[model samples]
Target: MQTFRTEIENPVVEKDIIDLANKIELFHKGKIDEEKFRSLRLARGVYGQRQEGVQMIRIKLPYGKVKSNQLRRVSDVSDEYSRGRLHITTRQDIQIHYVDLNRTPELWAELEKDDVTLREACGNTVRNITASELAGIDINEPFDVSPYADAMFRFFLRNPICQEMGRKFKVSFSSSDDDTGLSYMHDLGFIAKIENGVRGFKVMIGGGLGSQPREADVLYDFIPTDKIIPTMEGVVRVFDRYGERKSRAKARMKFLIKDVGLDAFIELVEAEQNAIELKTVAIDADVYPVSKPVSVEAPQVAIKDQKAFELWKSTNLIPQKQDGYVAIGIKVLLGDFYTDKARLLADLVEKYAAGEIRLSLRQNIVIPFVKEDLVPFFYTELEKLGLVEVGYNKAVDITACPGTDTCNLGIASSTGIADELERVLKAEYPQYLTKDDLVIKISGCMNACGQHNMANIGFQGMSVRTPDKLVAPALQVLLGGENLKNGKGAFADKVVKVPSKRGPEALRRILNDFEANANGKTFYEYYQVTGERYFYDLLNDLQDVTNLTQDDFIDWGTNEEYVKEIGVGECAGVVIDLIATLFFESEEKIENATVSFDNKVYSSAIYHAYSSMVNSAKALLIAENKSTNTHAGIISQFDELFVESGKINLGVSFSELIYQINKNAPTEAFASKYIESANLFLDKVRTYRSPKPLKGAK
Candidate 1:
């Protein structure tokens, strides 16, 4: 494990990997708390799997862009550390599961050699920044949003402000007004626009999906490109300070904005402007690397089935703004593919295409910069790898998470049901293969990892009980959700609950009714006309549990009797309230502050110092059994209990000392003074907590 230290070139990343290794050793030795260790590893993209004694590693791919070499690197790592399988996530990240926990640091180091990262892919940090897979090549886009998305991903990867927030933050950039990125469901969303020849974005803030889904509110109709980074920094600072800590359920940014109102949230964000480092960060799109397609003569290939080839082209070929070139979309089944197929696809693109592939938000793959004449050859090559499935982004293409397969929070089997549903779509409802207006998504639980709440037709896993106290896997059917484009969307309404065995029947009835009465209306329009009660009535008969057979007790893709087993979810991470751990974390924050100050990152240094003081105060407050729900609450309570009582005297009140972050601009002088004050405050707090000798006693 120590060999990784010399192999890694970047000192910061090397330190991170080394710290993870040391922490893992401490955890095994029972020195570090399990909750704290979970938080630490999750931020580094090492997640707990459903199976014991193993982990799932998520590889963060910004905007879903992966070079040919990077893909090959991921394949190699998956084969070495995991089970030689790669699972694409709805967030455009690739996850490999079933790896020993002790080997993660080395696995991460191997990935970094190819410029791939896992940092901030999970946990309570800014997650993978996703963009439209069609971003650069979309014909309808005013300009590509890829450069802006890339800049956002780079800026916050290890930023101080969002390192330890109440919950994770999500961001997206849409290619055009079509909202291909689904901006309305993210914490922060940007839509590309060019006003008066100046590039800018239409910004949306405070959106999220889970048990309760909230559509994002528009923060700005138009903000220049230079303002996006600074505005995001301010927003993150506000979320970190005021976001909930005690209750994981209410910790998302959407909940805070809801509780405080959007106007008040905007005010808080505006107040953080002075502490932001760069008020105007100009992103140079010209400097972004553009992939060039290989120049080669078209290869003539014989089409085995002309009809099948035409149908595939109709649904899979994407129109590009660049003339004489097209993009290909490969519909991956249930987002699961093996390393053998991945390597072949990587080689295919590197030889004839742009040497790159973009993973879509729908858990598929997109190959860009292919010459129009080369489609036949590419299709033939992809067909041999079993990647030529029809209905790319259409209704037949379903989106699902690795629910009961690997997630600890799964209540039922999402992937199994998704597989059966796709089979039904192909065998019975063949027309859906050409229909791109409808979407279907499933989730193992209410966390909405598969984005179930935002799909036109959605299913959420659950369990139902009968009169005899027998439990069976069930699904909640939701209807009437759709993205209206340009930062507008709706959440699906829960209509009915049915046994897992009856899921296929529910879908059959719903589709039969829609095909009979929809009459040229989109699924959303048809649902609105029919209403929720109509669908509830249509599938209500499937809810009868009185006559459930033995088959109903078994979840899809499994022969054993289903047991409703759900483990504690680590998506938002756990609250660390241990006094010793809190003090240790405070000292660590001071160290980070000093390092940032040395690196000349004034804003980052100031925030780190602020965090150190807040953490130290929270440590003492926890000792006193006081409330520490928010940073502001900690500061005010510390003043009342400790400062007013004169237990430990700082020159000024705690709030007065800490509030300088928002009051003063982030400069070298303030950063140096703030760090010094934080260190001094830590020393004072330590002395106050220490046992003192009696009067005249040494």
Candidate 2:
């Protein structure tokens, strides 16, 4: 499925991913067909993801290097075409969302001036080549492998053998044995080692741990540095030939490598690699130096004193082999940077700090080295850009992927929810920023974009409505998920199902209680020390179970609702927006269409339909308050809350929401009635029958 060609040797390129900067200049004036231009720009690897109506563009960082100009370009692209922020991905790639589909090509052409590219960033294609964030530095490293990484990337970029594989291929480079920088969670993880007096690598394959998690296996314990590419070619061959094709979920190299076992897989890899006669450059010390990256201008840190500079120095600095220079890591919250701020920072990096910047896996940015005297000025400049925040422990530092906001298969907006949760954590529990040894990740779907299964607390998106009612589905919460110091990271705790909106609060409560009562212990230790009986007792005591009675259902004109309930987490992203979006600045532009909520006339099902309605929903409106076909106890529970009556008058629907927000007086004030309403609305939706698309609907 792939055709090989060089930027020059390739024949007629109907697609020019890059072009004269003049076209880019024209597009800035809104004078070009940017989308038409984007389809051709090669440097910026922008492509549509699995989901429809969305674009996933990948920005290349040569050897994971970031320059001030490059960062400025990234910020500019994001501000002009995307959501004015960028996500620093685990793969060391920067991703922008909700891209103005029309402007991508123009963006690509402009990117070429920097020599960055997006080709092979994604698809059933080879992805952005990753390397150790500490490739040239890290005291324990054997040698800088940046050149090798660059060589392999250049050789295979859009190569016929790799362009369209049976599945996506991921690659990484490591300069040390401890696999923290280049994650072992990859299809190909190459860590440096010395074998038989020769500088080489320990190549591990298929080691991703998401959803159906698996550890990558080490096939070649010692691959001479010179032959790394051929070895990589071998692994790709094994993956292409044996990886599963029918089930996309099972097609990742992690699955194939696990299934075939390392021995057989390596044999296959070796076979394919043998066919290639690699006649390339010699591997020598002069191949690539461990010098400071090419500097456009020397920076002058501007601060006068040392105290502020010391704090900045502690958090922002990383040791590099280059003398008189240290790498400064600027922790970017949630990998988001405002465009104007980015431009200013780029200018600052150009003026006060290093001319280049590097994006880190921890969703942070780095600028390598300036004189100790300039560190203070650089700190002040960074402070102006809001890029100097320090992070602590797993919980408050969350990782979330874009969900339904701009992705195709997204079941929810994990990013928005993550942002909200981060705000809540920062505002409410100041201690969690430094105390909790936990991670919270939100995935838009069960596909594990958020790595839900690996977090101490994780959420995966899913549909939870019943047969008759159709409302926003909920997240399938996988509680007690964790990864301990390279130990077996457990997935969700199966028994507890919580609605997504309530999840943050619930987790907060648990942590709060643990912090208060546990005798000075870590979060995980506290949970373990407290044991299950105490944990359940505390949870039960917190919520008065007696209040959840059949009488509660009476409020909806239905018989008392009670049921044998099992829990499932609601997809938090989509459901949470039911209210938040009703208030976000730009979104508030849409005026409300007033509707009468005659609680006496519309039965619970009708009410539920109206309350739960959002972008896409199916509901059959009727006047009757009772149903002849259903009995009292057939239906059991809603994903959001437990319900008993088969045709329960659970008064919840989108119409009810429009009614509430537009009330003459706040109807659900002073009480958490909105939460109850959400649960009830979700419950009613769980009862919808065959969903039929609305005809002539907008």
**Angstrom error at residue 146, model 1:** 0.7
Query: What does candidate 2 score in Cα RMSD to the true structure?
Result: 21.0
lDDT on C-alpha atoms for all candidate structures: 0.92, 0.53
**RMSD vs true structure, all candidates:** 2.4, 21.0
Task: List residue ranges in candidate 2 displaced over 4 A.
Answer: 1-44, 49-56, 75-84, 98-103, 279-285, 289-324, 392-395, 434-437, 466-473, 478-495, 513-698
- On a 0 to 1 TM-score scale, where does candidate 2 land against the true structure? 0.65
Tens-digit lDDT track of model 2 for 1-698 = 12322343232221443342444555466544444333323223655554444466778665567777788777776776777877777567788766544466666555555566666565566677777677776777877777777777776665544533445777777767655443456678777778778877787777665567665666666878788877776566456445554455676888776666767776766655433445223466565544444343435545665664565465456777766666667666656667787778777666655566666655666676565445555667767676666442235777776665545566555775677688888788765654436677777776675667666667665444333433333455554554442212345443343344455665676667876887776555665665545555544432332223233222111133322122221111111112122122111111111111222211122222222332112112212122111101111112112223334454442444423421222222311343345444433433353234222211
Q: What's each prediction's clash count?
A: 0, 51
On the 0 to 100 scale, the lDDT of residue 91 in model 1 is 91
lDDT of 1: 0.92
Task: Give TM per candidate.
Answer: 0.98, 0.65
Candidate 2, lDDT over the whole model: 0.53
**What range of 10 consecutive residues in model 2 has the weakest lDDT sum?**
628-637
